[model samples]
Target: MDKFLKMTGFATSIISWYNINKRDLPWRQNASPYHVWISEIILQQTQVKQGLDYYNRFISLFPDVVSLANASQQDVLLAWQGLGYYSRARNLHAAAHQIVERYNGVMPDTYAELINLSGIGPYTAAAIASIAFGEPHAVVDGNVFRLLARCFSVELPIDTGEGKRFFTNLANELLDSTNPGDFNQAMMELGALVCTPANPDCAICPLRTMCNSYRLGNPFSFPVKSRKTTKRDRYFYYFVHESDKQLAITRREKGDIWQGLWELLLIESDKRLSENQIVRQLSESLNMAPLAVSHVVEMRHLLTHQNIFASLHKVKMPEKFNLVTFKDKIVVYTGRENLTDYPLPKLIEKLLAQYFDLPPKVL
Candidate 1:
C-alpha cells in the first residue's frame, strides 16, 4: 500500500507537464460530452494525427446526438469514410439513435448509464465519465499500462487476465479522486510524450527518478505481454469495372470484414489465385462472360492478424452486364467526384486510387 501511494504521486508531476505542454487538440478545447465521445471512438486503435480530421468533421456535421440520430446511416457512414473500422461508425450511429429515442437525445452523464449504450465498453465509459462529467473513474489503457509497469517494476504479463485485474485495481487506487479526469489524462500524456515505447525520454520524464524500471536501466522491459495472434496470409483479387463516368462497387454485408461499407468486386482465396482463377471468379461474381482483362497488378494490405495480397484486375464488362441494375451489393460511383460522398472501406479506396485516374492527394 505504501508503494502504491508512492507510485501514484507521479500523477502530480504528470499533471504539471500536461498543463504546460499538452497539445492544443480540438477535443481538449471544449469538454463537451458529444465531442469527447466522438473523439474517443475515433482514437481507438488509431493515431491522433489520423483521427484528428475525422473528429472535427464528425462534430461539425453531427454537432449533437439529435442530429446524428436524425441523419441517415448512409450520411453517417459517408462522414466516416476513410476512417477504418467500419463497425465503430456503425455502432456509434446505433448508439446515437438509441440515445435520441430512449434518453430524449441527451447523452448520459454517468459511467454506468453510458456503458449501456451499444458501442461503449468500460474504458470508453470511464473516459467519458471522468473527462466529460468529472465522475471519478480511472482510465487504464495501453499508455497507462506502460507508465504503471515501469514506475512500479511490475512483471505480470499485461496480456494476461491476472495482469489486467491487478493493474485495474492498482489504477483505481492511484487515481486522484479530486481530479480523476486530469490525473488519468496526465498519466496517458506522460506515457505518450516521455515514456514512449521505444527510446523513452527519461531526462524530461517526471517519474524517471522514482521509476523502478528506469533505475533498473530497462524501462522498456516492463509491461511484458503474451503474444496470441497468428498472422495468416490471404489473397484478394478486386475487379475494377468502369464504363462512362460510373464505376461499379458493392456493399459488404454484416458478418464479413469491412462490413456495412462499399467495396469493389472482391475474390478471396486461401492460396494466391492464378491468373486464370482470377478471371473465372470475376466472371462468376459479375455474372458476365470473362471480358478482356486489360490490366492485372498486385498489391499487399496488412491487417493486425492477417496479411492480404491483393490483385487488381481492370476489366471492361459486356454491354449487357454493364447496364445491369445494381442491387445492395452492386452500385456505380459517378467518377471520383462523388466518391467522397459514399462510405468505402480502405481496401476499396486503395484499389480505386490505383485503377482510377485519381487526382493528386485525393485521399
Candidate 2:
C-alpha cells in the first residue's frame, strides 16, 4: 500500500508537470480523431520537430479522413515523400480506404478496432484510442520504455521479449486510470523532455525523488538494449534519360526501396557493375540502345539497416520514344514545370538538384 501511494504520487506529479510544460503542438488542439491519428503516425519513426511540418502539410492536403481516402496513391506518397519508410505511407493509404469503405469514413472508437486497421500497431492504436477517444490504454513507445526503465532501474534488455512484457505490464499497472489520456501524454512528454537517452536532466525531473536510477546515480544504466541490427550493403545504378523537354521516371512497383513512389530508372545489385555491364543491363531493361552512357556522379546513402552505394549515369536514348510505350509501367514528366509535383526519393531529389543547379531540400 505504501509503494502504491508513491506510484500514485509519481503519476500525479507527472500530470502537473506536463500540464505546465508540454509544447503547444497542433494535434493537441482538438479531439479530432483524424488529427490525432495523423500526428501519431507521422511521429512513429520521425522526430516531433521534423514531423510538425509534414503533419501540417498532410492535414492541409488531406484535411479529413474522406479527403485522404479519396486521394490517389501517388498524391499520398507525394505528401509523405522524403519522410522515408515508404511502407508507412502505403499502409496509411490502405487503412484510410479501409476506414472509408468499412465504417463510412468514421474512425473506430475502440482500441480493438483501431489495432485491426492497417499501419496501426499496439503503440499507435493505444495513442489514438487514449488521446482521441479517452480510452485507458497505456502507450509504450521508445520514450516510455526509456522513462519507465530508468524510474524503476530495470536492467532487462529492452529489445528482448521478456523485457518488453515486463515494461508493458508495468506501464499498464502504473498508468493513471482516471485521466488516462493526460497521464499517457505526461509520461511520454517527460521522457521526451527530461528523461532523454543521454544526459537526462535529473535535477529538474519531477520523478527525481522516487526514481530508482536517479538515487543510484546511474540513470543511463537502465533500459539496457544490447542487440544491434546488421546492415547490408546494396549498389544502385540509376540512369537519367531525357527526351526533349520531357524526362522519364518509373514507379517502384516491386517491394523495394521507394516503393509506390516515382524515381529514375534503376538497377539494383549486390556488386557494383562496370560501365559496359551497366550499358548492357540498361539496354536490356529499356529494350533499346543508348546513344551514350556517361558516369555523372556517385553517392553513399545510409538507411536504418542498409548502406546504399549508388552511381548515377546519363543515358541518351537513340530517339524520343512514345510516352505511351512506358505508360503502363512508368511515368513521363512533361517538363520542369511539373517535375516537383510528383514525389521523389531523397537520393533522386539530390540528383535533380545537381541537374538543375538548385539547392537540395530534405525532409
Candidate 3:
C-alpha cells in the first residue's frame, strides 16, 4: 500500500505541474484526435517552434482525414516541403488513406489499433492512445526516458533494447490513470522546460526533492544513450534550365531524398566536381548543350545522417523541350508562374526565391 501510494503521488505531482506550466500549443489546445495526430507526427523529427507553422499549414490545407486522403500525394508532399523526413509525410498520407478505407474515417482509439497504421510507431501509438483516448498507455519518448532515468538515478543505457523495455515498464507504472493525458503531457513538459539536456535547472524543478540525480549533484548523468551518428557528405549539381519565361524540373522518385517532390535537373557525384565536368555532364545528359552555364552559390542541407553540399548551375536551354518524359512515373516539365504548385526541396526552393525572385509562401 505504501509503494502504491508513492507511485500515485509521483503521477499526481507531474499532473499538477503540467496543468499550470505547460506551453499553450495549438495541438494541445483542443486535444482533438486529428489535431494531436498531425501535431505529434510533425513534431517527431522537428521541434515545437519549427513545426508550428507547418502544422498550421497542414491543418489549413488538409483540415481532416478525408481531405488529406482525397488529395494527391504530390499535394501532400508540397505542403510538407520544408519539414524534411519526407517519409513521415508520405506515411501520414498513406495512413490517412488507410484510416478512411479500413477504419471508416475514424482514428483508431487504442494503441494496438493505432500501431497497425503505416507511420504510427510504438511511441506515436502510445502518445495518441494515451492523450487522445485517455488510455493510460505510457509514452516513452526521449524526454520521458531522460526524466525517468535521472529522477530514479538509473544508469541503464537508454539506447539499448533492454534499457528501453525497462523504462517503458517504469513509465507504465507511473501513469496516472485518472488523468493520463495531463500526466503524459506534464512529464514531457518537465523534460522540455526544466530537465533540459545541459545545465538542468534543479532549483525550480518540481520533482527535484525526490530526484536521485539531483541528490547526487549530477542531474545530467542519467539517461545514458549509445550510438553516435556519422554523417556522410553528398554532392548534388542542379541545373536550372530556363527558356523564355519557363523553368525545367524533374519529379524525384524511388529511393531518393525529397521523393515525389519536384526539383531542377539534378546530376549527383561522389566528390568535389569541377565546373567543366558539370558542364560536360549536363551537355551529355540533356542530349543538347546549354546555350549558357553560370555557376550559382553552393548550398548545404543537413539530414539526420547525411550532409548534402549542392551547387546550383543555371543553364539556359532553348525553348524546345518544354516537356520531357524521361521514363515511367517521372515527369519533367517547364513552369514559370506555377513552380510553387509542385513541392520542392528547401535548397531548390530557396534558390528559386533568391535567384528567380519568386515570392516566399505566405502563411
Candidate 4:
C-alpha cells in the first residue's frame, strides 16, 4: 500500500462521493436483514434492473424469514420466476427455513453465524453483518475486487485462489472500523458506478489520485482472470399442444434445469437434432395420436454456462383421435392467458412470446 493510500483516506474519499452519488436502490434504504439477504441473493450474477422487481415482490410477499419459511416451495419458485439461477431460490428457501427453525425467526447478526447458513457465502455474510448489524467486516465482492485491483494496480489474476486471498486481505485492510457499513457500500458503489470494467470514468473518480492503474493511464487491464470452463450447447424440442385454444404444459421435476416450473412438453437432445428427429421424439414421449403437425419454430437462447437451442413444434390436436393417454400422461392446458402465474425461465418466456405471437411484458 502507498503512504497516502491508506484505508482512512480511501474511506473518506469514497464515502463522501457515495453520500451524494449513490443510486437510491430500495435495498440501500432498507436495513432489515431479510431484505438485505434477499437483495444480495437476487443480485448475485444478475443486474440491478432485472433483480429490482423480484426484490420488491419477494419482500412484499415474504417480508421476513418466518414468512419465507412458511411459504411453499412452489410459491417461492413462482416469486422467483424469470430469475435464471434456480439454486439461489432453493438455497434462500432452505436458509429461511433454517433461520426460522433454529434461530427462532431472528437472523444471525454475525458474519460467522450467517456464513454457517447454507448458500450464504463470505460476501453475503459480510454484507449482512456490516449493513444489518454494523459489524466491521470487510465485504469483498466482484465490485470490490475491481476497485481494489485498479487502486493498487494488483497484478494477480482475480479468478485464481491467490488473487482472491490477496484482494480479501487488501479489502480487510481498507475497511473503515468506525463506519464499516458505509465504507463497504462506498467501495462497491465506486466500482459499480465509476471504476467499471469497461471504459472507467477515471476523471470523475474520487480515488484517482491514489489509484495506481489511473496513474499508469490503463485502468482496464488490472485484475486479470483466466477462463477455465467452456460453455456447452444444449438443444430442446418443445411441443406446444394447443387444444380448443388451451396450451398443454407440465412442471419439470426435481434435480433438473428449471425445476418445479411449468413448461411445454419437452425433448432435450445431447446435440442439435434435425427436424425429423425432433418430431419423432415429441410424438413418442407425449404419445400423441396420429395428427397433423404445423409450423416448426426454432429459437436460440444463451445462458451463462450453456447455449440453449429451442425448437418449438406446434401440433394441432386431432378432433377425434384417442385422448385418454395424452391427458393422463401429462397436464394439458387450453389457453396461455394466465401462464405468467407459473414459474418459468426467461428463455422459455422469450420462446412463449414468439410462439403465442404476443410481445414481451414486464412483470
Q: Between the candidate structures 2 and 3, which one is better when assessed by lDDT?
A: 2
lDDT of 2 by residue, 45-85 (tens): 89999999999999999998899999999899989988999
Per-model TM-score, in order, reads 0.93, 0.93, 0.92, 0.92
lDDT of 4: 0.82
**What tens-digit string does per-residue lDDT give for candidate 3 at 123-205?**
88888988899998888888898898889877888989999998888888888877888888898889888888886888888
Off-target runs (Cα >4 Å) in candidate 4 are 2-7, 288-290, 320-334
Look at candidate 3 and tell me the lDDT of residue 143. 86
- Model 1 off-target regions past 4 Å? 6-8, 323-336, 359-363
Candidate 4 lDDT by residue in tens digits, 129-160: 99898998898888998888888888898889
In candidate 3, position 47 carries an lDDT of 87
Give all candidates' CA lDDT scores. 0.81, 0.85, 0.83, 0.82
Residues 177-233, candidate 1: write the lDDT tens digits: 888888877887787888889979988888777788878899879789887779999
Q: The CA-based lDDT of model 3 is what?
A: 0.83
Better of 1 and 3 by lDDT: 3
Clash pairs for candidate 2 = none
